[model samples]
Target: MQALKGIAASNGIAIGKLKLCVKLDDKIAKKPITDVEAEIKRVESAKEEAEAALNRIYLDALKRVGEENSMIFQIHIMMLQDDDFFDAIKDCISDEKVNAEYAVWQAAQQFSTMFAQMDDEYMRARSADVVDISKRLLSCLDPNLDSGLDSLKEEAIVAASDLMPSETVQMDKSKVLAFVTEQGSKSSHSAILARTMSIPAVVGLCDAFSSLKDGAMTIVDGSAGDVIIEPDEATLKEYEQKRDAFLQHQKDLQLLKGTKAVTKSGVEMEINANIGHPSDVEMVLENDADGIGLFRSEFLYMESDDFPTEEQQFEAYKTVLEGMKGKRVIIRTLDLGADKQVPYLNIPKEENPAMGYRAIRISLDRKELFVTQLRALVRASAFGKLAIMFPMITSVEQVKEIKELLNQVKADLKAEGVAFAPDFEIGIMIETPASVILSDLLAKEVDFFSVGTNDLTQYTLAVDRMNPQISSMYDPRHPAVLRMIQMAAENAKKAGIWIGICGESAGDTELTRFYVDIGINELSVTPGTVLELRRTVQQLD
Candidate 1:
């Protein structure tokens, strides 16, 4: 028996045969080109074909997953059409006079190298996008290349060096029981998609288990981040028992659905879901979520070719609001820039984007974009209980600016005779250390505060949580982070405004009791954790 350790990305277990999916070897030989114009034409034609393929993938992904998840394909399409990307390829073809395939490959390598050398892990991960687009263009130029993941005869544990978003989206999901990657992290696209699909996944194996033969019997313990190849009889039996117990535990957690999230001492707290798109409402209702505490509204903007119109944004908000059936839904306005980039926004490149032009800062500066979203949210508010929250807020001035624009939007809507809820609530996300310290002053201006502990912890600890190298230091349970949360919670209490945690820390069961003890009014987590969080609340004294 051979055992390999990896990062536990998704929580589950699968016992199945191994299917080694080696990426297609698309190495192209450079050849002197007689006609540089012909090479440029060929590259352009291949780009057009790649665009068509990506559009098809985007549509398919939209139908399968919601627009939020489907935006990855759209972003891929944008990368293909990017002026810089196209210029690089054209420059290679014109200046180097190389074959179209080699030129594309060289251009891709240049951009990939740039991203890989970045200090930020998220930006570094973008190298995969450049590689994926290059591979697609290469495949378009040479049709013989095979990805090997498109065809699967039976359910098996897929092993690969790594998976790009396009490749993961195109694979036969039913045949893929689990995934083991030699290179990846929890924030990788494959990991994110695996969690969304509720499939077992273990990444960052780093070539340790790459020698395992194809079709070998394997046990993937995703919860423990262990991949066992050709396990002995005794070991297999032990895993079988453990898998059964885990499955049974999942079944038992379902009974907690529809139950109140009240503590044993009669302290009732709201248990909400953090959703990315409208389709997530189904999972929220299935898990009996109190409401959506964070409806990420950036997907609409990201998926579209241009800015999302007010009606488009309104329909999305309306869908979630109507589906929740009067339950409170907090829609955060366009948290763009930073890690999440929209090319058309023309946000200048920054050395450190996380602390740069992003979230509320962008909205405050781009009043028209901010107003468009506000108008839609206000219009949708009339359908059900809807509240708007601003992200990355660090000062009273930002909050004041947002309120002024919101008032303008409300006045414009009222003058136009548009029906909207006049009393809709406004809140600010307490993410930065400054926000935590100034919580008292900010609380007086907003209806409530939702501590975005993900950023709060990162900024407070001076650690980038996505950077695997220093990820160990990015602990939410750190004394400084806890103190900030406590300070925010206490300030909200004094101001008579509710405060909730809508970050990954909210789902940490080990900290549930501490959150309760600190008087956190709400805990907004992913839908899968809603019942578990409710169970934790129930057991809290």
Candidate 2:
């Protein structure tokens, strides 16, 4: 048996034949064009057809995936109509005097390469979007090409270099048992689509993926990121058993929805969801999460061209709060700076951005920005249970300062005859070492402690988790990081305050028992993983 490891893109297991998929061919021979206007007209016609195709795809994706995930297709439609992209194609056709196909291909390459080189991960993933739409346009120009998933007649594990959003959506999903890609990340549209589609997937297999052959028996343990090819008799039987058990395990876990996350010993832990936008509240409720643990407010800022107005922020907070139906919602105040830079904010470049002016630093420096968000949260709190948390907190002074600001917001609201929830909780994220060290003191001031382990691990280990070169060194399970978390948990307990982990680490089912043992009050993860975490807790003592 030969095995390959990759990033676990989606959860589940599959055992089937390997069916290799071919990517859409973007290579077109350049032909000198005599009629520039005619070629431009052709490009314009193809562009409209592409947009119409995307609109249809958007509706199809909306049915398969939710509105939030389906928005990517709508984004592609917008990209097709983008002035710069359209103008680039027209300019290429006019300057290079190339065929419309060649001009579209050239413009796509230029933009895709530029996006791929960007510092932001989200923008980097957009390179695929450019290529996807270009291929759609190419197909519209010529009727012969397709994304290549239409040939599958049998259920098999689909292997590809990297599946694009359009290709993944257009594929006959019923025939695909699992997906194995040579290049992709969790943030990629393909991976996100897999999760929403509930298909087993393993991506970024790189060189190991070359060994895969058509019609070969394969076992894909997506939950473990393992792909086994041509397994021997014993190994095949072992995996067959494992696959059966996993399928049964999934069915078993579904029964856990709406049930509390309680261990065998009857210790309960709140299993909440981390959401970037209000639209995600549907999935949180679908998974029956205890509440909303981390509502990343920065997405509201990141999505807007300018700062989101107080009423805009209020509506968003209100939508989520109302959606949760009185369930506890913890909103992390604007964590702008570093990787999540807003162009309008005009934050200066930093040598090491992760540790530099970010999170609470930005909030404190620009008090008005912070005040705007707090004012929105305060006004929305009256709709449902809400808890506001400050990120990148290092000292008691920051928490004290935050409370003073909160008090002023309350006073202002009162004088203006605005009713707000006074019983809402205030908390600080135990991410920095300073916060962990001073958790004993910080706990007394705050109502609770929510550990942002993603940052805590990086900060404690002095490793940039985003740097692929050193990502291996940034272990959240490292002893030092665990020690810091344990210290904070102990301190919170000592101070008689509840504590929880609202980070990527919380989604790790392997650590479910560890968290329960350490007296963690809650585990906030992706909405889809809530039941799995509940299962882990129930199985543990």
Candidate 3:
């Protein structure tokens, strides 16, 4: 038996034979073009074929994963039609007199290299998108290339170098039990899709391809980040029992769906979802979420090539608000900077971005961007129950400034004859220690407080959660973090405003009782954990 450790991208256990995904080697040697005009025509034909393929993928993803995720393929289609991308390939073929394949490769590399050099992690990761679309175009350029998921004859665990969002969306869920990738992170699109589909996934297995053989019996313990190849009889039996128990546990949790999240002592608690995009509302509804607690509004900006228009942002917000059907949806204003970045934003590179210009700082400094988002949220408020929340706030003055700006936005909207909710609530995320210290003062201004424990812990413990060297020091359950949450909850109560936790800790069953005891009104988490959390609340006195 050979055991390998990797990052657990999803939670589940799968016992199956391994199927190595062999990608088509589309690497074309640089060659002089016999006919420049013919090569250009071939590139155009390939572009058309790629667009058609992406459109089909978009429709399929829309049916399976909803519009938010389907937007990935649509973005690819847009990228293919982009003048810069299209012109780059044409220019390379015409200027360099290279073959169509070589020109496409060069264009992809140039763009991908630019993105890879970016300081922001999210923007740097976009290099993968350029590579993915380029691969699609190359596959179309070669008619004999078979670069698609083959039908599996038996249940198997798929092992690949990495999977693009478009590729993963098209995979057959019935035959593929799980995904084991040689390269991926928790925030990768493949990891996100695996969680959405409830598939077991182990990513960042640096030597998975080298260590495991095709058709070998494998046990994928995604929760523990273990990939066992040709497990011994005893280990296999143990894993079989574990897999069954995990599935049974999931089945049991399904019974909690649609059930009220009230404690045994009759204390009603709001169980909400933390969503990143509009399509996540489907999962929220599926898990019977009482409302949406944290709508990370940065996703709309992050996914776009440039700043999203007011109408675009309004439509995105409206979709979520309308989908919830009267359930409260709290939209947090642009929490960009740090790990998330936009090329057009032109945020200066900082040595310590976490503590630097990010979140509320950027929003306040870039008033235009902030007002545009505020305007959209306000306009969307007329569609359903919508609340605005600010992140990384440390002072009452900031709240005062934000309210003043919000007032300006409201007045502008009113003057323009735009319809919006007249009495939408405002809130702030209690993440920094300074925020916790001033919670009493801050609570007096906002209608509610949502503790973002992830950042709160990081800031309180003085540890960067993303830094592997000191990750162990970044514990959310640390006493200092708990005390800060307690402080915020107490201040909220005294101010007559509801307080909630919208962080990873909110979903922790171990902390559920602690939160209940502290008078927290709500706990918002990812959709997958909503039912389990509901069950936890129901069990609590």
Candidate 4:
């Protein structure tokens, strides 16, 4: 057994023969392209293959997980079909006169590379998207090639250069457990998916691709972020026992499916769903979620053309709130900008779209944009319990400004005598390091704080996710990030404000105990993880 250490992208444990899944990116990069037509053909072929593979993935997910679960593919589907992407590839082929494969890939690399080089790390990390597209092309061109994952019959560790959201989602969530990425990060979508799938995975293993050969005995610890190769008997036995214990614990915890999430000390911790659409509310109910902790209303903006009117917003909020009944709901207002290009919102093109107008900042700049949402939330609150929260807040003054606007919106609503929730709590997301450092000050002014760990970790570490070069450095367990979360939680506590986590870290089962230890008041997670998360928290006290 050969052992190689790299960054752990996803957290999960798997013991299986190494089913080497080499990324064909290097191969695509090496392929020679002589003309623009060849490049176009290659690009089109990749798109077609991506479509077919993605469709298979969707079908596979639906076949295994269910249709609703498969809807996650919508964006991936759109990416393959998006005219912007095609146009980019076309321009590359036409201008560069390269083979179709190289044209699409070269264009994608250039496009993502520009964003990846931005001063804002969060925006820069977006270059993985280009790699994602390139992977689709590679996967498409090599139609007859084996998935590599399919050949593994016995329990074995899986190896890949890195994983994509679509590829990971299509992965057999059960049989081949755990992740070992030669390249990637803990913040990658692969990591997020591993957590969601409850599979232990480790990423950023630098030599995982070049070192580990097929059929190697691999051992990994999802919790400690440890992996051992050619483990001696003791190591193998220890992991086996640990794996079994975890499996049993999982069975026992599911019994808490409908039970209230209380610590052993009997403190109630709100276990809610972090959802994107009103339609997902039923999923919350089905999964027995306590309520909506992070209701991302951004989906409404993403799906609509024009700014969603107060009525449109009200109807959507009503559906979500109505579904949750009297349960508490914390709704995050529209978060859109260059990254989330909605046809309706005519947002200007920016070189660094991620750092450009986005999240609450955008809404605040365009008061009408935010006011419309505020009115809808107020109106919907009248019918159900609601807590409103802002996203991407980086300044204390922004909090105060929102308070003033809330007052004005309230006064306007009262003057109009519109039936609205008489009272609503206001909160802001702590996503930037600036906000994290000043969380105590901001906490005093807001009703609650939801740490957007996704952005927090990205901005804090300065790791551009799209550029796989430095992506290895981005880790949630990095002492610096842990300290930040600890400090923010402490400040929020000092300020006497309830604190919740809504980013990728919130729903993490392994991290639940860590959050509980650090004084997290609530955890807003995906609906599917609610039951397991409740169980994880139940163990804390």
Q: After superposition, how far is residue 193 of candidate 1 from its true place, in Å?
A: 2.1
Alpha carbon RMSD to native, model 1: 2.9
Residue by residue across 387-408, what tens digits does model 1's lDDT show? 9999998899988988888888
How far out, in Å, is residue 426 in model 1? Answer: 1.4
Per lDDT, the best of the predicted structures is 1
Estimate TM-scores for all models.
0.90, 0.79, 0.75, 0.77
In candidate 4, how many Å is residue 49 off?
Answer: 8.2
Candidate 1 error regions (>4 Å): 23-42, 58-74, 83-103, 119-122, 471-473
* Per-residue lDDT of candidate 3, residues 1-541 (tens digit): 8999998888899999998877444447688976889999999999999989887886666546644445567557757777898899999999999988878888888998997777654456558788889988987898544345535677889988888887788788898899898887765677767876788999889865579888999999888899999999999999999999999999999888778999999998999988777777888898889999998887677657799999999999999999999999999998877656566789887766778889999989989988999999999999999999999999999999999999999999999999999998999999999999999899889899999998899889886554333444767789989998998999999999999999778977889999999999999987888998898889886
* Superposition error at 210 for model 3 (Å): 1.8
**Candidate 2 pairs with clashing backbones:** none
TM-score of 4: 0.77
Range of the 10 consecutive residues with the lowest summed lDDT in candidate 2: 463-472
Candidates' lDDT values, in order?
A: 0.85, 0.84, 0.84, 0.73
Instruction: Give residue 209's lDDT in candidate 1 (0 to 100).
Output: 61
Better of 1 and 3 by TM-score: 1
Stretches of model 2 off by over 4 angstroms after superposition: 1-9, 16-19, 23-156, 164-175, 184-197, 214-218, 228-241, 302-306, 337-358, 462-467
Q: Please list the residue runs of candidate 3 whose C-alpha ends up more than 4 Å from where it truly belongs after superposition.
A: 23-134, 143-147, 150-155, 231-238, 262-268, 276-280, 296-323, 334-384, 392-395, 407-423, 431-438, 453-487, 508-519
lDDT of 4 by residue, 1-541 (tens): 4455665544445676667775565555434445667567766767877777776775565434333234445446656677877898788768766656566667677767786777665556556666666666755666543355644566667778777666677566556767677766665667766765667887776754576776777777766667677788887888898888877876776677779878787777788887766767777787888888888776666545467788989998888788788999898887776456665566776766666788877888899888988888888988788999988888888888988898898899889988877767788888888888888788889888888886788788876554556765756667787788889889988888888888767766767778878888888877777888787767776
Ten-residue region with minimum lDDT total, candidate 1 = 61-70
